[model samples]
Target: MNLFDLGWDDFASKSFHPFCSGDLVPARVALGHKHACELLSAHGELLAECTGRLLHETASHADLPAVGDWVAVRLRPDEPRAGPASRRRADIHAVLPRKTKFSRRAAGDDGGEQLLAANVDTVFLVTALDANYNLRRIERYLAVAWESGAQPVVVLNKSDLHPDPAAIRAAVESVAIGAPVVALSAAHDESVAALAPWLRPASTIALLGSSGVGKSTLVNRLLGEPRQPTGAVSDAVGKGRHTTTRRELLVTPSGALVIDTPGLRELQFWDVANDSLDSTFADIAALAARCRFGDCAHRSEPGCAVQAALEDGSLDADRWQSYQKLQREQAYAARKADPRLAREHGTAWRKIHRAQRMQQRLKSGE
Candidate 1:
């Protein structure tokens, strides 16, 4: 098979370096486990491990290859590394610079973001139209997708379970703003073709959603086989078991590479910048541009375009509020990174509140 047929273009674009040209063999990490990885090279599939030196010098989690990382590997002659003692163990010499990385804050207090996949061209934010459909949650996923630097496509899976798929699509489009939202049932073979545009060759797409949302089912449908198992949904909760335990890189017959990740129960925000947040909330940003003041906070600020739009029915209050909530979350997350800045912002807030109280007293003639 040609290199391009196995999703090589996307991975190579990120990790290939001129300096490493000729000396190293290129391989894409198909699956990453704690001990080793499954790598797909031009020659064939191989079981690989990082050199002890590479492991010793590793500074962060990102240093270790993740699913979809294009790595520079020190080739071992036909035989697999004999054992732990062998010096010829496949070593990850280096990782090519990534074109795009999809990440979310790791769950819990670590405060570190977990890299979900690297060099992804498209992110499929899957949401189901059954009892689990929640537009607000879709908005949250869009924020993370936009932040990942990949084009986001909202996939409304399990549409057959819902009588009004259009309503669910409209709800997703409401917050999606500029994203493409498609409704289909991954359980049904024909319905899965709706994702054809993104399933083209050389493209790398990752499926992300909460567990039991049919992420695996969708993956199996696209594969045209039961490569991934579908879990049975509970009769009471309408949620299925989390069938996918690890992230895997699967090559489709169409030559597209798809990464199926275990569903994310929580997506914490580590340090998403305002640009992504702005992109996710573009509608509010566009409305805010016409605010009377250059720095209108949109909270009772005279002629505040966002507030005006909300009152005049040009914008949805729920969406506007969601934008503000996400904005505050991003701002707080940023502040958490810098102690001095956090302190400064805390003091500023107090002073601003104090000044506002005084102004209110004067306006009330107290």
Candidate 2:
């Protein structure tokens, strides 16, 4: 396979040059498992594991290989293999710097970043139009997409189930800001063509959303085969069963690369900056510029444009609230990631607690 078809460029070539003189070969990670990975190299598809040195030298799990990541691997061609059970394999030594990455806070209380997909050019934020339609969720996805340094296109799947797909697209457009919103039923082959603009050859796109949002179905449609499993939504909760358990990168017949991620049960903020948040909530940011106070909180602050818009029904109440909620969550995540911010937050809370205690003492005539 040509490296260009895998989204490789001169930049990647230069980055891999230092390793090329050695026994290492360039490859792109296709499927990432618990301890092993499937890579697509110039020699063809092969299974690979991280070298002990690589693992020991890595800072965290985020440094490990992820689907769509380009890496240097040492092929074990001389090793005798039996059949399909023992195919060609290699050891990943190094991961090239990613041009773009989609990530979220790792699940659990560890407060670590989790890399979802790397070197992606576009992110398809999929959402089912059934009972699972949610604008707030879309906003959250958009914020992360912007943070990933990739163009985000909102894909509203299951359009056939919705009475008015256009109306649904319009609703998504309101929160999507400048991002394109595509409404199509992935169940039909023709409808999937709507995504062709973003599915260009030699570029990579990732399917991300809550489980049962038809991400796998969309991949199957694009592949023109049932390569990915599809499951029915439960009649009780309208949620689809989790079929994709891991992230896998697949090549479409048109030569475009697509990564399908397991349905995200929880997507928390990690490393989301103010610029990305402003980009996602451009409407709110624009309004904030006109506020009388430079540091306007936009809550009950007087002459706050955001508050004025909300009162006059100019801004969607839900969108504004979603922005505020995301802002707080992002701030909290930042504080957790930075010790100074955490210390300042702790000190402020301590002051507030002390003030409350003083008020209580005064009431008690102490």
Candidate 3:
């Protein structure tokens, strides 16, 4: 396979320049296993393992080769391997810097991030029009998508199952905000073509959503084959059965790259971007900016535009709640990840509350 077809470009070339002079070659991770990963490079497909130095220097599992990651590997071509198929092997020496990464807090309370996909150009936040669809869940996914530094496209799959997909699409549009909303049944080839605009040559797109959201079906549609397994939705559970067991990247005949990952059970905030709130909830941010108090909590602050919007019909009550929930989650995650910052936040909140109490006492002529 061509390196360009694996999403390699000038930026990647520059990143691997130091390793270029050595026996090392650049490769893109196709499928990652426990201790090894399938890589695509100028030498074609090969299975590779991280070298001792690479492993010893790695601080976190997220630093390891993940699907859609580019790495510098040293190939042992012409060397005999003790394998049934005599497949070639390589040693991954280094990983290239990721331009964008989709991450979430680990499943447990480790206070660490788990990388879902890396170096992606676009992220398709897939959601079903079935019972699995939830506006708040879409809002949650949008938080991480905005922080990933990639363009988010809300793909409302399984439109055929909905009573009125157009109405549902409008509802999703309200929460998706800056992201483009595209509703289509991935079961059809022509219907999935609506995503063609983002499937440019040498660009990587990741499919992410809860189970049964048709991410594998979307990949198969784009691949023009049934490479990724698909499972029917269990009527009893109202969720799609587990079909994709692992994450894998495949290049289309048109040179576009697509990655399909298993359904995420828990989507938590990782690194809250400085502008994600402003970008995802522009309406609320704008209203807050117009508040009379610079630190308006939007709760009981006088001249608070947010509360005023909620008083009128301008703002959706549920959306404001979702924004607050996400903000709290991000703030908590930040504090948990850093103890010093946690103490500082505690102090800050105390000061704010004290100030509010003092103002109330003065108003009461205490």
Candidate 4:
């Protein structure tokens, strides 16, 4: 397959222009190994590792080439990254510009960013109908997916297990604003058809969710075979067994490119603008806009539209709480990423509270 078949285009050509040379060739990272990566090039698949320049020059792990990333590589017959060269060993020099990338805070106390998927066109947030399903989790996925510059699709898998799948879909739809919601049982062959619209030829879609959400089963269903291992959900916990251990890119028979990832137990945001949060909870944002006080906290503030909606039957109280929780979480991440932001965060909230008090006094004619 040529570069075009691998989703290469003019933008990629331009992004890789500076690195174009006789020795370098364009390749896509099909799989990322701990010390090496499997790359797909015109000459075929080759095992590659980062050059000394890339290893020392990159600022963080996010800078390295990852699965689904197009990169400039040198297929040297003699110069492998480590020891003697293999059949078609390669050295990844640099990664091309990523049109879209899904990222999250690195695991543990380390304040770092982890790139989940790069150069993806769409992100399928899969969740099972059993004990793994949660509206809050879906909202969190939507927030990161929105910030990733990719179209978000909520896949409600294991529909066969739920008696009221339609009702659950309706409930999920209420929170997954501006994103398509698909309900299907990945075990059934016919269910693959529901995911066909996003599986267009050459387009890239990444499947992401927590363990036991049927991600591997969904991948196998799309492949028309059991290439990926599948496991049954534990009856005691109603959760799925984790089968896929790593992230890899696969091409379906229909020609669509897919990146399947291991289940994420915790998903925290990296440094991101509030636009993503606003997009995820647009209903709350729209209500907050109509509040009498611009600085109104959704608590007992007068004419607080968000509070009003919570009091009436207009908005679900859980969703409102979810929005606030995400807001706080993202804020904390921002502070950790930038110490200046951390210093200003307290002052910023104090200013808002002072303004709120003034607004309240004016509204009360004091």
Indicate the residue-level lDDT of 352 in model 1.
Answer: 100
Estimate TM-scores for all models.
0.85, 0.91, 0.88, 0.87
Q: After the best TM-score superposition of candidate 2, give how far the Cα of residue 330 lies from its true spot, in angstroms.
A: 0.3
Best-fitting candidate, scored by TM-score = 2
Candidate 3, residues 1-366: lDDT per residue as tens digits? 788778888878888888878788899988865488888888877889999998899988888888888999988767765766755799999989888888888877665877888889999999998987899998888878888888999999999898899999998898788899999999877899899999999899999999778988899899898877776532222353432234388887777899987777779887786488668888888889999999998999899999999999699999999898889888888787677998998999999999999999999999
User: lDDT for every model?
Assistant: 0.78, 0.87, 0.85, 0.85
RMSD (Å) per prediction:
5.5, 3.4, 4.9, 6.2
User: TM-score: which is higher, 2 or 3?
Assistant: 2
Q: lDDT winner among the candidates?
A: 2
Worst 10 residues of 2 by lDDT: 234-243
**Candidate 4, residues 55-136: lDDT per residue as tens digits?**
8888888888878899899877654345334447889888888988988898988758888888999899999999768999
Candidate 3 deviant stretches above 4 angstroms: 81-86, 232-247, 343-366
Give the clashing pairs for model 4. Answer: none
